[model samples]
Target: MNDKVGIVIVSHSPDVAKGAADMVRQMVGNEVPLAFTGGDPGGGLGTSVETILAAIDRAWSEKGVAILVDLGGAETNSEMAIEMLPEDRQGRVVVCNAPIVEGAVMAATEAWGGATLDEVRRTAEELSPA
Candidate 1:
């Protein structure tokens, strides 16, 4: 796996993140790395920063990583996650606002082929009509 890509999804509810991850996994298979974060502050519906950060690390370890966020806490959570990542790995992570389904599908497709984080993000942004 000289060239590989990883995925991370963040949302207001863990269900949303997991659902998106599951769909992407089904589409792309289990070969590549995938991470998801969501849930409420007091409830167990969301993952801790450590969990998300670990996933981010694993994703970055390969080729690069792309992060997709739904809305609400997903945005703030992703931003915090990026800040917590090691400085060297910062460039490997891209936080994008593409729709969960379309963005993830496109990102996973490119990731399966080992696309760079920037490439995946650019593709996602291009796909986004917003």
Candidate 2:
């Protein structure tokens, strides 16, 4: 019953994304697949579509993948990354509209528990304001 789903964290600051990923890893241990992408290619505060895409690829799982982003641009770039995926792969990827840090922690924990993608996304989204 290996029902683990993968997670991808995207943020404008590399440190923020990495830190959140670290926290999630601490929470879920190695039971879930996690990847993070932050900052521009030049190492400045910005998100990159390519980086996001790569992180998604690194964290790819048969169960599914959920993405959490910090801000509007991060969300936009994440959408672009998903779009760039092949048609077959795109359906399994979801961009979650939840707070990056909290969402990553919640999603990772749910995935570790063998939750499906919808269940993990719901767990993360439940933390957002109504």
Candidate 3:
């Protein structure tokens, strides 16, 4: 994998997550690893820990992964996903406290510039809170 940090978009609605991931990919290209997930197991509007975990896996990078979530529930599920990862991998994934769509784009842009995990996270967080 590339040295750039990865990006994961999480939202309660599948369409929102997919749209945000699409925007990031359009702007950042394939320079950074990217993945996204949303909705509960039944495909309703709710976050899923399992889906978040899968997104993390798809976007895995040795550098780290930054997850941008749409709401508090998404943040909570993202936390659970991070906790479920191996001890060595847990800290490498973080749930960013920023708007999902804007934050994902910003974080991905920074990651494309070869920023570290913390740098990408800070870039996302610096935006107005979601």
User: How does candidate 1 score on lDDT?
Assistant: 0.75
lDDT of 3 by residue, 32-118 (tens): 999989888886899998888999999999999999998889999899999999999998999888888889999999999999999
Clashes of each: 3, 0, 0
Model 2 agreement with the true structure over 22-55: per-residue lDDT tens digits? 9998877977988998999997999999999999
Evaluation by TM-score, superior candidate among 1 and 3:
3
Quote the lDDT for 118 in model 2: 94
lDDT of 1 at 29: 84
Alpha-carbon deviation at 62 in model 2, angstroms: 0.7
Q: TM-score of model 2 relative to the true fold?
A: 0.96
lDDT of each: 0.75, 0.92, 0.92
Best-to-worst order by TM-score is 2, 3, 1
Q: By TM-score, is 1 or 2 better?
A: 2
For residues 14-130, what per-residue lDDT tens digits would candidate 1 score against the true structure? 788778889988988877777776776577765456666866865654577888877656667777878887788777777876987678878888778777777878877778885
Worst 10 residues of 3 by lDDT: 121-130
